[model samples]
Target: KEILLLLVADMKAEYIPPREDVIMQNESPDELYIIVSGEVEMLESEMENEQTVWTFKSGDMIGEVGAFCCRPQSYTYRTKTLSQLLKIRTSNLIEAMKTRQEDNIIMIKNFLQHHKKLKGLRLGDLLHGVGGDYGDPNMYVNLLTVASTGNAT
Candidate 1:
């Protein structure tokens, strides 16, 4: 899937005020969020106590692990400041996945593995499908080019 265009075409942009939870820990996962502005805090609940695990800022994509895996959200994501996010419904992604062949599954799996080290805006930048200073534009171009040409080298 062309996640950038898919998000632009299929997601909804929402503005969230500060100190509000975008999603709560253990909530039923429904959508993936891409941070467009401001910061978000990721928290985990343990024995009724919440602990901050990580912080996501503009350009970060969150809630995908649970949504893509069809599981409950593992952490709470709250706005640390005023924020804007693009929300992609899990149902949309599932529908898209259903239309793809087996190779797309592997491609998505590899894509997930490749994205593990990326964070926040940098990751978001890559997902936008636009070449930027933070990520190599050629990577996406090359990947698509190869796929289109039926070459896997």
Candidate 2:
């Protein structure tokens, strides 16, 4: 099963040029972009203030929660330099996963892991309570489990 997923069909990739003053702080729009190459900076916005949260590189997935939930974006990401990305529409990803069950399962696992890592960081930030920091790690884990089991709602 793992081998089958490793051999699954690959998606097309796209390239983006560097831009100045890119807003890395905005609500998520539920889109997933797999970083094929280049760099991106993640930022969070609160009360007219923006802070750099993280930097993503190749093989990293962005906007997983939004892609899963079909909700507003929770963070903002901007290219730190010229970048190449595989833009996977959430609807298309969901459909493809349905067709390729094994591969879909692997993808779901990867998404869940990424979600957990992000959720942990966000939860820690919330504990500090210096910003509009609010997140539920358990809820995210539950969502992933439900979605992967084909019981998402």
Candidate 3:
């Protein structure tokens, strides 16, 4: 279905200078980014401290989970060197996906798999309590309420 062409139709290329922060921890993802060049560092932030937990290079993608699931990303990403990135706004991608049901389903599956890999990365103790569960502690309650109330609520 040429998902790349569908996504690229409304894509924006970003040129980020060294040390620029591209994504921040706990912020809801609005866009998905594919690294085109240079380097990006993913940082784990807690309290007032932040540390680099991973480094992303050309061809790596970020914000897939947040863009697909409308959740917050657990790590913050910043450019470590001059970087070129291809960005796709969530709204645009969703709009295109709606036109092709099969492709949309496959894309969502891929995003979920990508999220799983992020969690499985070997970090051990540093990852004891890190990752996607950073959503609202009350979100589950709201979801249950919606389920009981009705999907139209």
Q: Which candidate is the best by lDDT?
A: 3
Candidate 2 residue pairs in backbone clash? 27-73, 28-72, 28-73, 28-74
Candidate 3 regions exceeding 4 Å error are 112-153
Evaluated at residue 67, the lDDT of candidate 1 is 63
Model 1 over residues 1-153: C-alpha lDDT tens digits?
Answer: 464455458889999999899887767778989899999998766787887767888877788755654445657889999999999898877666566556455646554654665645333332332334425544654554454355786
Highest TM-score model number: 3
TM-score of 3: 0.71
Stretch of 10 with least lDDT, candidate 2: 123-132
Q: Rate the local accuracy (lDDT) of all candidates.
A: 0.68, 0.62, 0.71
Candidate 1: residue 151 lDDT (0-100)? 71
Instruction: Write the residue-wise lDDT of candidate 3 on 114-148 in tens digits.
Output: 54476546322212333345544345334433433
- Candidate closer to the true structure by TM-score (higher is better), 1 or 3: 3
Q: Which residue pairs overlap in candidate 1's backbone?
A: none
Q: For candidate 1, what is the lDDT?
A: 0.68
lDDT of 2 by residue, 1-153 (tens): 533343234455778787433323345443578888888777676988878777878987776656665545556678888988877666666766676676776777776676567643652232222224445445655666876677766
